[model samples]
Structures are given as C-alpha cells and as structure tokens.
Target chain A: MRKFFPFFAVLIVFSMLLAACGGSAPTEAAPAAGGEEAAPATQSGSTLQTVMDRGKVICGVNKAVPGFGFLQEDGSYAGFDIDFCKALAAAIFGDPEGRVEYRPLTAKERFTALQTGEIDVLIRNTTWTLTRDTELGANFVATTFYDGQGFIVRKDSGITKLEDLDGATICVGAGTTTELNLADVFAARGISYTPLVFEGADEATGAYEEGRCDSYTTDKSGLVARRVVMADPEAHVILDETISKEPLGPVVRHGDDQWFDIVQWTVYATFTAEEFGITSANVDEIKATTENPSIKKLLGLEGDMGQKLGLSNDWAYNIIKYVGNYAEIYDRNLGPDQPTYIPRGLNSLYTDGGLLYAPPVR
Target chain B: MQGTVPESQEKIPFWRNEHTLQWIAQFTVLAGVLFVFWLLYANMQRQLEMLNLPISFKFLQINASFDIGESLIEYSRSDTYLRAYLVGVLNTIRVAVLGIIFATILGVIVGVARLSNNWLVNKLAAGYIEILRNIPLLVLLIFWYTGFFLKLPDVKEAINVGGTYLSRRGIAFPWPLPTETYATYRWVLWLGVALAVALGYALYRQGKKTGRMPLYGLWSLLLFLVVAGIGIVVLQPYVMDYPHLPDKGFNIIGGKTFSPEFMALLSGLVIYTSAFIAEVVRAGIQSVSKGQVEAARALGLNGFQTLRLVVFPQALRVIVPPMTSQYLNLTKNSSLAVAIGYPDIVHVYGTIINQSGRAVEMTMIMMATYLTFSLSTSAFMNWYNQKIKLVER
Candidate 1:
C-alpha cells in the first residue's frame, strides 16, 4: 500500500490535467446542444430559437461612441445603436426592457463575438464593407447610418485639408475601418503621416487631446460624437474632406438565414413606420383604425408577416411601441437637442432624398 | 507446502496487479487528453465551417491594407500580411534586444551600488529597486508614455538642441546616412573587426602563457580605430544628415527619428526589468561565500581584483539561471507595447485579426511565434550557462 501511493499520486495528477482540458469542452458544447433540444419550434441552425430559449438577445455593441452606443452614467446603455438592439429584443421577446444583454465589444472582437455565438446580433455601429460582409461571415442588414471617414484637427493648427496633414502624427483607433481608410487615402494622395493607433476610441481621443497627435481620424459621425466629450469642443474642427464611405449597420452570423430575416425586417419595420409617419404614441390608435393595406401589413393587422419571421403577430407593434420608429430613434439619440447632433443628411429616408430605402413590407 | 511458501511469492491476478493498474491508468489518462483535444479541434472546425470561415493560412497572402507607424523595413499598405507580420516580429525583437542590453548595464550598476559602503548610494539603489519592482509593468508603461513622453511640447513648439528636435511627435536626431562608398567601406570595416579579433585572441593566448597580462582589449581597439581612420580618410563612407524643420510641414525632415511610443516603451521596459535584474545580481553576488573573499584578501588581492578575478566568475554560475528568466520576461513583456501603440507583433496581429476575420489562425501563429522566441532565447541562454559552469575535475 505504501509503495502504491506514489503511483496513485501520479494517476491523480494526470486525471486532474485531463479534467482541466475536458471540463471546459462539455460546458461549451453542452449549452448549444441543450438549447437545441429544449427549443423544438425552429430548425437547428436558427439563432431565433436559441435566443428564445435564453430569454434575452445578447447584443454586441460599442460602449464609447456617444449617441451611437455609449454607456450612460446610470449604468444603462443609450444611443442609436443601443435602441436598435432594443428594437431587436422587442421583435423577439415582445418587450424591449430586460430582454437584452449588452456585451460591449472592441472593434477587433465584435465580429468574433458574433461568429462564435457569444452575441446574438452585433449593432456596434459597425460599417458594412465587402470584406466584412463576405469574408467575415457576417450578414449586414439595412444601413442604419450613412457615414464617411473624416479627420479632426485643432482649430488653431491651420490644417484645413488632407494635403496639409503631410508628415503629421494622426491618432486613430486600431482594428477599425477608419484605420484602413486613413492608410488608403493617405497613400493615394501621396501624403505621409504617422498613425498612432490605440486599442480603443477613448485612448485615441485622449492621445489626440493631449496634442501628442496633430489630428484624429474616424467616422465623421464618430468625430461629432467624440468632439462633444473633448475638453474644449469648440477648439477642434472636423475637416471638410470625406475620405471613405462608411455605411454603418447591424450584423449577424451568416449561417442563420431565419435570424437574419428577422433582424432585417425589424430594421425595415422601423423604416416603414417612419415612412408612414407612425409614432409610438399613435401606433396603437393607427393599428385600431388604419385602413391602408401596407400599414395593416406593417402593423401585423392584415397578414402573417410576424409568423413568417417566427414571431408573434404584434412583433412589429412591440418594436414601435417600445423602441420607436426610425425617425424617432434618430431624434431621440442624435436630434437637434442632443449634444451628439449631426444633421441627418444621407441617413434620412430615400423618399426624403437620402440613401435609406427599405423594401415594402408586402 | 503452500503455507510454507512466502506470501510475496504467491501469484496475483492481473486485475489486482498494481503494475497493470498503473499502466491502465496511464493509458486512460493519455486517451482522455487526446480525446479532449480531438473534440475541441472538431468543434472548432465545425463552427468555422458553419460560419463559412475555414481555418486556413491563405490570409497571409492578402494585402494588409494597413499602415504601421514605425517599421525597420520599408512597408506600405500594399504589402502582404506576411510582410506586415515580419515587421511586427522585427519590432518586437528590436525592443526586446535593446531592453535586455540597457537593462543589464543599469542593473549591474544598481546592483553594485546596492552593495556599496557609501550610505546614500546604497539607499538610493535600494529605494529604486523597491519602488519599481512593486508597481505593475503595464501601469508603469502607461505612466512613462502619457505622463513623461506625451507631455513634451508639440512639434510646432519643439525644443531644438543643435540639429536635433524634441517634440511630442518624436525625437529626431542627426544621423549619418550611407553614401555610395559605404558599400565598399563596410567590407573594410568587417576586415578590421576580424583582424582585431584575431590579434586580441593571439595576445590573450600569449598573456595566458606569460606571467604578465597585456592590455589586449585596448590594443585591439586601437588597431581597429587605426584601420577605420584610414578607411574614413580614403573613402568618405557616410554623410551627416541633419534634421531641419520644413517651412510648410509639421515634421522635421531628414535624419533618424525615434517615435515617442518607442521611447516610452523602451524606457518602461528597461526601468522595470532593471529592478528585477538588479535583485538577481545582488543575490548572485551575495551568494559568493565570505570565506572566498577573505581568502582573496589574504592572498594580497585588492577589492577590485578580488571582485573581478574571484567573485564574478563564481557568482555568475548562480546568476545565469535567474538572469535567463529575466531576459525572457523582458521579451514577453514587450507584447505590452500594444497598450502604448508600439506596433509590436501582438498589436499587428490584433489589427490583422480584425481586418481578416481569421482570429483562430492569427492566434495560433502568435502562440507559435512567442513560443519560438522564448525557446530560442532559453536555448541560447542555456548554452551560455553551460559554458560558464564550473569545470569538474
């Protein structure tokens, strides 16, 4: 027995190591497998059923950008992107409040979080690019905001144009489309600049504020939002030059078509509601009295559109009632009264001479 | 007859056999570990396939389309991801190597000072070591970057000393630029170095044979200087490139520039690592027995002679092992360069992972790269340690 003690000790150590390795595997695999078995209403690859079983939509969002997905002082998430996540929650769970788990992700990890099912949907003010759309295995829904890459310099720096930025150190967020655009635009125009890339937007802006960099570059909307948080907002001026198109939108993993359709129509429902001049206050009255065929279809009164999306008939109504229409979402977050206000130019609906056009619900 | 036979000599069933049990346990554990790994691999593959992002290295061939702030080699956005990865590798190596060199020098000085009889010197060294070693390296790096380097004046109001300019952007100094004749002069320089080495080796051997030791290092340095002087006189190998503020630009053109990020990271690494290394050196020196020092003194050796000849050689045997770990720590800590925007391998790989949604491949590559770096460093250090080990009779 004494001689066998050492052998038993060795066996225990080996088993512990094996347990350490094997333990995490089942925990990871078990949840998905169990969720699949527990929810039989939908197919296996459906994110909708998984989200239903979980009872909350795990939304990947940015926590820094003001009026887009910023975290508030009261520990609640606010802004346009946050509202869209709420809209998604409302569409799925019939209630926007308490149905979302906001996972604040960095620009580098947002897609990975989506691909790995860590988040049900990513509404992180992420841009829709060909590379992101195709290679990242993410399906971009309707463009929520049309933006462009722009630079902001100190008002007194006398840097008015792209050519004037030659040989200047520019601060930018790492792993962002803004970083790639700055590189491409500078290379194209024969401008030489040093990019001090920070891991987060706050760090980049902080560096720029310290005058360590002559300028900071990002999405124009982001610049507008971040500018309000600067020490002296009036001291910095965004350049007039637009470097690249940034059509920001929500994203989801590509394999789940039903989930993709649900997210897409949820965004369109907001657009359709805005186009029809439906407000959250008047949505119930309009649903009761409206005779228009499209309005009836959009409000889920005349058709099985919500059922087609594996949702209740009142899903679109829930979205409007809780999260509001597109215009209301825009006005709530980036309206004239808001500090992060940017005049809605290209983000306005197509009928109002902008790029936002959602296909008809019928 | 059975009772007379020893209980130890009786045959045991295979099921009850301890040897068989041990083997079974070993095989079971091995199989379990392999099965776990296989399960993880299969799960990853299935998930990746479902997402239409198969694990492959083909992303390396794609254009990186991102610009790094500083690189040792010429790189543009048109460069491949592989080239960008190499740039990151080179940047990491540059900081680690420079950090090791500077840290060693500072550490040795501080370590010696810690043991000095001078009260102020000893206390100061102790204070430096205690304060620096207690703080987290990341915080120290951030402090050095934002508090010290970034606090410098902006480029327009740069502090100029002679032809050098110091600003928040960087410190640009006048450096020698290679001319056409530098190619030919380089070979002559190498030849001079080789001749100096040979001469130094021969003199060392002669000194070993004779009772009197010669100044081989000084002689070798003088001979090399003479050769270099002749070469300089015959061929002007380089021209001094002075940095000057362009009338219309924000940056000083010409000469070499060390970005504030690089300086901050290097200084942080050097200072933080030097503290730990100083303790190692102190411990190593203290490990040398007091009796050995007394013996050297009895042999009429001075303090300096006792240290140089008797103490350091013996102390090194104890020092080299811990010192190897310190060097590795510095190398790995260089990855923290990402925090301050130093564009090290980890930072570059992060950007790559974002640009191409190939996180798995990039992470694996990063793991393999760091492993290679650590293994090679340890291998070289082990060789040196072995070389310096006391020879057994």
Candidate 2:
C-alpha cells in the first residue's frame, strides 16, 4: 500500500482531470444553433437591468484586428470599435472613465463570450449575418460601418479583377465570413479557386506577401491595412469588386429592451452630437454659451430624456465632453488629421449625406 | 504489496483521532468543492437568464452557410454544421495517423544513430535531437508555414519534384481516377478491404499449418494486393487519378492536393516528437544486457540476426512504455492546428463559438475534443503496450 502511493496520487490527479474536462458550465451549450429563439426572453431578463443600475457597461471588442479593434501601443483600446464602445458608455453613464470596462476577445471567442453574458455589449466590427442573429441568439444594434469583401494581390501579378483570377489560389483567415464568402462568391461566378486558410490575419497576410497564394482576400479595410505595410505599396492591387454586403455593427444578446434601447440611442447620440457641432475640444465652451433649444435638449438641459433612460440629466453632455462625438472620433483615429488616415467615407454625418445619421434626438 | 500497519506512536481515542479527522477533512473538502461548483453554476444560470444569451443547437440542422478549405468528406455551404465538424475530425485524424507513422520510423533510425560508434552519425543525431526538442512546436509551425513553405515560389514558379507539384499552395501527386465514380466505387472499396483481410488470414493459417517459415505479414500483403488488382478490374471503380498539371488548373478537382497547413503541421509534430522517441529508443536498446549480445554471438549468428532476434526483442520491453507516451503527445498536439489554421477540431469549434456567440459552450466543446482524443490515444497505446510487455521471470 505504501509503495502504491505514487499510483494513488496519479489516479487522483487523473480523476480530477476528468472532472475538470467534464465540469465546463452546461448552461452555455447554446441550443444547437436554431433552438435559441424560444429562450430569448429568459436570456435577456434581469441581467440587463442590473448592468444599467450598476451604472457601468462591460464592452467586448477585439484587440488585434487593425481598423475595427486594437489595443494601441500604449495599452489603451483604440480603434473604430473602441470609439463606439466609448460612445455607448458615454451616453449611458456620462463619464466614460468610471462607466466602462473593455474586454478584449479573439475572433473565435467573441460570440460565445457575448452569449455567456461575460460582457454586456459587443462593439466589435462583427458582421451582422442571418445565422448569427437567429442561431447565436444575439441582437444586433444599428449598422455602424458598411464594409465589403475585397482581395489584395501582388502588383506584378497583373491580376486586374476577380474574373482574371479564375484558377488562382486565395488565402484567407480561418473561422471568418471572409473565408466562406470567398468560396461562395467565386463558386457562384463559376470560377474555380483553392483556399489557403490561416488561423490569424498576421499569418495569412504573411503568406500572401510571400507569394504563397496568387491572391489574399478579406474585408476591404483589412486589405488596405495589409497593403500599406507591403515592401512596395504601389506593387499590390485591390480589385474593384466588392462581393459581399458587410453591415458591421454593435451587438447585445436578446431581451432587456431597455438596455438595448440605451445602446442604440448611444450610437445615434454620437451622430447627433456631430450634427450639433459638438467636439470634445469645444464641448465645455459650448455648454456655457449655447442657448439653442435643440442643442440644449441634446445636452440634457430642456428635455427629460436622461430620466426616461435612468441616467444623469447631463449624460450625453458628459459623453461629448469625455469621449467626443462621431466626427471627432473619426478624425482622431482615422482621418487625414490622424495617423492611419482612413477616409471618413460612409461614416460621416448624415447632414453631409454619408449615412452617419443619428435617430432624432428628442 | 505490504498491508498498512497502523502508525506506532499515534493510537489515540476514537473521535479524537487523526484518521477520523482525515476522513472528515476529505468529506468536508468534497462537500466544499461541490458547493462551489453548484454556486458557480447557479450564478451562471441566473446571469444567462438575465442577459438573454439563449442556448440552442438548432444551428446544426440549418445550412452552415460556410465552406471549409480542405475536406476529405463532401462539404459545401449547403451542408449542415454537423457535417462541417465531422470533416474537421477527419482532418485531425488524417494528420495524426500520418505523423505517428513517420515519427516512429525516424525515431528508431535516429535512436540507433545516436548510439553508433561512428562520430558523424552520433554527433548528427545528438544535434538533431537537441535542435528539435528545444524549440516550441507552435513557433516551429509558424516558422515552417511562414518562413519555409509559404516563401516558396507560386504555382508558375513552383519547385517540381520528379514532376510532382510541390508549392506553397499544396503538394500534388499522381493518383487513381474514378472510372465508375464514387457511388459505384463503394463496391471496389469493400472488395479491396475484404481481399486484404482474407489474404492476411490465409498467410497466417499457412504459416501455422505448414510448419515452414511463412512470411506471414508480407505474403498476406502481396496476396491482398493481387486481390485488390482483381477488384479494380471487376469493379473498374476508378481510373488513374493522375495529378498531372492540366488536371490541376486552379484546384486539383480530381487528385488530392495536400494543403501546406496539413503538411507543415504533420512534419513539425513528427520531427519534434521523434527526437524524444529517439532518446526513449536509445535507452531501451541500451537496457538490453551485454549477456544477450554475447549469447547471440556464441550461437554463431550473424550481426543482423543477433541484433534482430536477441537484442531487439529484449529492447522492446523497455521501449514500449515511453513510445506509447510519445504517440499520445502527438495526438494531443494535433490541436496546435488551431494556431496555424489547419481547420482541426479546435479551429472548427472556434468558428462555431464565434458564429454562435457562445463562449462557454464553445470552450467546453474544445476541452471535450482534446479530452476524448487523449483518452482514446492512451487506451489504444496501453493495449498495445500490454501486448509487447516482457514476461518477466
């Protein structure tokens, strides 16, 4: 018996191992994809109200995808997704600092984390799709960014368009709509292609640069991001065709219409802020002097909107003061005034006809 | 095994005993653990209901609306999610099976080389083992995929090895084509397997009955090949699926073009694992005593016979346990395909998680996959280990 102590210890460890393997929370078995609809009301029940009452928001986003979500070198979340998260926190709790917690997620883990209620809102530049909404049981908010699937190829390859590359091999990141869409669009067109799938964008793009595949496809923004770092930027060509409809947006699980309403209104508030000529730099001065009724109502002076949503009267004002509005966020993070210099394109204010329209501020 | 004798110094009272406390402590701990798990589970359920992250697997029945890159079984966007996952399982098994074969061969060769008297072979084996074992497998996979394979020239500039297509895209080779197509080919497959089994069994019976040295395994293999040839003639299920260039325009629609992800991962795991196996083999070989070698020599046996009959049979006793462990490691390492994007079980589950928006569920699935893999591998290896274990005197 004494001699068998080691075996006993090992047996104990192995049994524990089995237990650990089997012990994963059964609550998360996500109903085989289609069985989700019936349970929506139950899932979104009390958790939404608790988050609202707590006066802080848990936001999940990616920290690696270049334009959508990324942690800056200084260790703060900085990207299109981050800005939107900040906007929501600003609208809900007023001060972006005390009101928000940013949780970074990988491409694969984002959906499950959302479903498990690990985070309140997912502001990642995730594509809104049929399966995701219906099967995954997530409720998508307003479409924040309109994107398309595009490809990048070497300059000398002389691959002018998608049709020219019929028999070409295309590289794409794994576990993404980018991968599925690549196959679908090409196959639908009767063009044959072999897909070289990769786990990470960095790896996929590396292979593309090394000429492993004749072409590499991803979101149009990702193509531009990869192209900029190439040895010779002018050498690569982005094909003119945008194959898929990518309505990128913020998401939360179904239920809690109140919280959902608050998040949706936050996104609109930014666009409205921009329309009202509010920028982070001048928000303080405008509050002191601006007497316009519309501006005052937006800034929470004349209207009881903040009370209706259960927040401080000046929640939008604080959001504008701390996080800035739509145009300010874009210029700081992407426009020519900043580093990445991504054009404001479709993300500009609605008054200027670019689709960054906020719902009426009333 | 010695029975447990009560410790000499501590024969205290009934309730005030260390043994009694030990049982109490264990029960308490067990109860505590269960309580904790229960509380955690309860909390999670509450939060889930509160957040509206409805759980469902109805997604499996619906069209997956996705396509996998390299599939052994038929997979299309039109297929269900379950089919996609099945394809992933097949891909994992494919690489794992091939990796084990190559690693075992390489390990035996290198293990012997390490014990060689020749300085070159000995030093070379040592260096190979050291280099491979030191680097992490994840890093090696990346280096192989990115620095080596992916850097190779495109299809136009691909390095052709004896007319076989080897490029960053994949390795293409000549293979049999289906003359009668896949549906009719089932009979050929069944006939081929049946013939192979019959051939092996007959060879075994012949060896046992004739009392002559019958090359059982080899003879049976040959017979099986002949049967397969007849099956191919009768069924005419497939033609030569030549992987010639014209047939591989954009994709090798006929012959399989093995992806570089599969190749790089397979080679990396095999090479890395073989180094450890080499050490195990070397130790096993050395563990065979000097007396056996001398006895073989005294019997006037040649070098090969002495090594094969006496030394090898002895060494196998020590070799199997560690070698089984190596095989288990290779299977588990197949999950590293997630990092390199090989679309193995982990990768597919990851996509499921992302698509479904269920993190805990996806993670549980990933854990279950590796756990199941580990159990099956160990079970098979242990059974084999028992089969070859020495009958000690």
Candidate 3:
C-alpha cells in the first residue's frame, strides 16, 4: 500500500485538478447534471444558467424509436423528440443551430442517465408513470403525446384487433411498461399468451419478423416504424384498439422545483404558441402586432415573466422564431404528409379540439 | 557508519535506516490512499445531499415487486429488496459451485489427453482448447441460446420421451414426487454417500495393513447401492413426476423445468473457463519430471495406476492454485447473466440501484461479495496446497 501511494497521490491530485477544470467545461458535467444527482440544482436544474454559462443544453434522447427519437441515414438525430430538443434550445439560448448536445440512451439507461446529471433534460418519449415519478425520484412534466399499447401482426395472420389472437406469442421489450400491459391485456381477455421478451425493441422486431413470435406489441407509433423494415411492410396491420394509456413526455430528476417548472413551461410554451396562432414564419409579424394581453405577456411583450423564470424577455419569441410552434414541429416529423405519416391525434392544439391546452402565462 | 563503542558498531539515523524508510513509505502511502478515498466519499455525500437523492438505504426494506425467473430459495415480488439480493447471491453460488466441479474434471481429462500418444485423441484435445478459449464468452452464450437452443420446437409441440419434456423452454426431466414418504429422500441420499466415503477409507486402511488397496471404487459403488437400496425401500413408494402441458395456460405445470436461459449461460461459462483450466492443468502435468513416472513404471505399475499414484498427485500442487482463481473468475463472470437475463447478484443489484437509488451501497455490496468469494476459495486451495507440498526427505 505504501509503495503505491506516491503513484496514487499524483493520480489524486491530477483527478482533483481535472474535476475542477471539468466544472468549467461543458461535456463532462452534462451527464452529471442530468443523471443520478436526482436533482438538477447540483448540475442541470439551473439549466438556462448552465447553458448561458456553458452555451449548450445537454439533451438525452433515444435513437431507436423511429420518427419519435431516432437517428437518420446521415448520422444526425432527426425525429419528433429531436424537434423538441431543438425547441428547448431555441427557447433558452435563442439559437437552434448548436446550443443542444444530444446523447442517445437505451430505454433502461435513460432514467439513470437523467438521475446522475448526465443530460439537462430527457426528451426521449419516455412514459410518465407513478413508479418513475415517485419511486425512481424523477419528475415528469406535461405530456407531449398521448399513446397506447398496440400491435402489428403479419398480414397473412388474418389478425386485426387485440382480442383476435388467443394463444399467439407476442414479442415485447423486457423491463418496460409494455411488458406489464401485455400481460394485463392477455389476462383481461381470458386469453393466454406467450410473451417472448427481448432486451431491446430492435431485437424483438427482428425475432418477430423471423416468425419466432406471431406478433409484436408496443406503442402504435413504434409499430409503424418497426414494420417499415419488414420484408413485407404492407402485410402487417396495427390493431385499432389501444390498450393501456401511455402519455410519453420529458422528465427531470426530483428536487429543483424551479428547474422542473422551467422545462415544463418550455413545453407548454410550444403548445401555447400553437394555440395563439403562432408559427416560426409568422412569429416576427406577431412580435410587432399581437394585441391579446395574455399572449402579449406570454411572448414577454408585457410583464416580467422572463425575470421570474431567469430567462430572457423574448425567450418564447426565440423559440417560435427558430424551432417553430408545436404543430409545425409535429407536422415536420410525424404528420401524415411527413415520411412517418402518423396522425396528429392528441398532439394538436386545444383550438383544434385536442388536449394540448397551455396555461395562461399570467 | 562505524560507530559508537570501542567494539566498533554501525549506527544509522531513523530516516536513513532502510527498514524505517520502508515503514514510513508504506504508512505514508496508506494514509494518503485512505485520505483520498475519504475525500471522494465526502464529495459523493455532499453531491448526493445537494441533489437531494435519497442516499440512505431505507428502501431495501421495500417490496421488490419483481418476480425472478429462476430462484433456488423461495422468492416473490412481495419479498423485500434484501431477499431479492439473497436470491441473486444463491444463483451466483449455484452456478459457481456446479461450474467449478465440472470444469475441473473436464479440464483434467483434456489436459492429460493433450499429451496422449494416440493420433485421434491428442489433436482433438488441442482443438477443443484452442477453439473454445479463443472465442469470447458472450458470443458463445448467444450461440448456445439463440443459435441452437432457442431453435427447439415450442412447448405445445415439444418432443417428449420416457416422460421427459424437451423444448425451446429447455429440458425438463421427472422429479421425485413430493409425497409425505419422499421427505426421507435426503437421509437416503446422504446415507448412501456416507457409505461410499466409508468404503473408500476402509480400502485405504486395508492397503496400509496388507500390501495392496483393492479396487476401492468397486467397494464404494457396492456400498452406495446397498445403502441406497435399503434406504429407498424404507422411504417407500417415491413416485416420479413429469412435465406436461398446463390445462389453461402456456406454462409447464409439472416436473423440474430448466429454463433455456440458465442452461445457455451456465454452459457458456463452464465451457469457456474449462478451456483455460485445461491449459493450466496440462502445463502443470508436463512440468512434473519424467523420472517420477519412470520410477513408478519400473515398480510394475500400469499406466492408469502410475498416473493416479504418481503424476496426478504431484501435478495437483501446481494445478490447484491456478484452478482456484479460475473458479473465482467464473463467479465474477456470472454477472454476464444480465446480458442474457440470468438475474445473478449484479443484475438484481443493478435493479436495486435503479429502483432504490443507492449506487454507493449497492456497488459496495457487489464488490464485497466477489471479494469474499475469492478470498474464501483461495484460502481453501492454499490449505490443500500446503498439504500436498513435496517435503524434503
């Protein structure tokens, strides 16, 4: 032990200096701020301050969920979640180009990454569940999209709905809420099912395609993207009935209530912008002529909303100008006209008869 | 320096004394290491508190609410986190215990066979060691599971022979029916094993008195069967149970079921480690002097007799020490059970760390468990090694 100390002493000193110097840099602290710290105050909760100080918002994402959170062919992250990542960056630093650093994590590793302060905020389309919020010590903000359990079966199987398959094997991801829902749905229908659980969705989808399992069950959105790679994509059909509510949203660790409110309100700002007839192309025009008092206040044209949140007066303005409002982001990624071709469904603004109602800024 | 008295003595200052310098260096390093460790711990505590993470281990008492696929002791989701950890510990033990025994036996055979004069046998042994050891354990685990085992026919259409069920689920053989009479099974098995051991001792004692130890294995086998037969009769009517399809579900309802996951993981571990152990044993054997075997052969001993008496006993002194480490390595590598979902100690603790948010405590437990296993195995082998030392005549 003694002979090794001189060596270890140098190591200790070097590491200490490294940590101190690292605190000034941006990358290393992102995981520490976003992960196991379980609160952002130690690292990420004062996110805008960190970004302003460091000039980047660290975003945790998933590269597997195509159209929601996935990588494109060109080695860039592009999906619905990616847009929100841009939205958060645009809202805070007022620059959408390079203010965000995205780290894609596996489904099981996402929460630990957030708790340990690795990322500033998690926008990985994770489900908001009681166990996650309370027991795991994470705080889920407003829902970004409301989804439910659905399945896709080979078109030749002649199975169309949830109750159609009785003894068929279903492939689902292990350690996911999907596993539990798969069990409950089969139990409720008085049908017995063989659940072949894989560690990841990619593997499960592969197994299903190989006919190891008769069907694969996940969120309907996931099923669509999964089927595109199948040998016969048109042969597979997603069940119409959605079982088990899955409200996918962003999350931050508990504590730092102030930090939670900031990320939450940023998401609401996107919804609120869409509700007030806001779009990236029209944002500049509205900045000059918008007259509604609440809208005016929200856009930082009236009260000191920015001061209360420790943000710029035109924080929401920058968000709309750069990232676009909620509808614009959705249409670009998951809209029927987009390559993904998913319906807006519950993601539209309240004026469009959907559930995306944002609170009044005042 | 020549010193002090008229008798001429050497004296050195404390710092200049070699012994004193060594001591000082040791203590200084120890103190510095301890200080840095304490500092890291303090920083962790401060960070954890600052972030308001529940760093305390109050959550271990909470219900785990997660069922294990394979458990030696009774485990349920309703059990506490501590119980879940114990289940993992038991699985670690179960795999390690069986793997060590099987690897040692297989390793010795292949090790000895590698030097065989026979054309077919020597190359085969060499080939087995090279191919298995060169590939990584994870690849072999996948090969065992998805590549071969998962390709078994589904349970509903499973192959059944002589009341045994074989399917993708895994091989399920008949177990003794758990009847009131079958409760005496332990006594019968133990008594039979004890008799066999006693028979071996008797043969050794007879060898000391007379000039020869008869075929002790034969005596031991007869003793085991006689005792086992009598015990079985007394413990009467032990029935056999076989696996069959459940009336209303997909699960197998009867007989002893082995999940394919456990079989694949264990086989991979055993095969990979055995290959290394085989090389160790071969080197140990080859290191033994040819004179030892020549002397035994000149004494009119046959090949089997010479090997059992001369080659193996001496070679064990070398083989046992490294063999102990391979056993410990197998124990630690059991953590790979997670990749294949075997739910060993690391996997359960990983979940506990995630659920309870007790990273420091859980990590300490994992390290301590492995360390204790390694130390205990080393201690046993060390004792055995001392007993086998070549005492100078």
Candidate 3 chain B: 10-residue stretch with minimal lDDT: B1-10
Provide C-alpha RMSD values for all models, in order.
3.7, 6.6, 4.9
B1-393: candidate 3 lDDT, tens digit per residue: 323334454567776666766687777667756766676666677555654564666777987755455689987556898998998899889888888888888887888788889988999999999999999898898888777667878766778898888777677888877568665777777878987998899898998899887888888999988887887777764677877886543446678977776788888888999899989999899888999999999999999998888898888888888888888888888778766656688767766665565666778888899898989988988898899988879
Best by lDDT: 1
- Give one digit per residue, the lDDT tens place, for model 2 in B241-288: 655554334444445677888888988999999999999999999998
TM-score of chain A of 2: 0.82
Model 1 lDDT on a 0 to 1 scale: 0.89
Ranking by TM-score: 1, 3, 2
- The lDDT per prediction is 0.89, 0.75, 0.77
Interface RMSD of 2: 5.9
Which window of 10 residues has the lowest lDDT sum in candidate 2 chain B? B245-254
DockQ of 3: 0.24
Better candidate number, 1 or 3, judged by lDDT: 1
Q: How do the residues A1-362 of candidate 2 rate in per-residue lDDT, one tens digit apiece?
A: 24544654565675576455445433333334355464444333345456777777889987766556777689887777888888777776666776778898765667767776689989877888887776565788888777889988887877788887887777887667887798788779888776767666777777777776788888787677667656777888888888997788898876656667777877777778888888888988888899888888878888888777666678788778888887777676666754356676776776676877777778
DockQ of 2: 0.34
What clash pairs does model 1 have?
none
Model 1 ranges with Cα > 4 A deviation: A1-46, B1-13, B16-21, B211-222
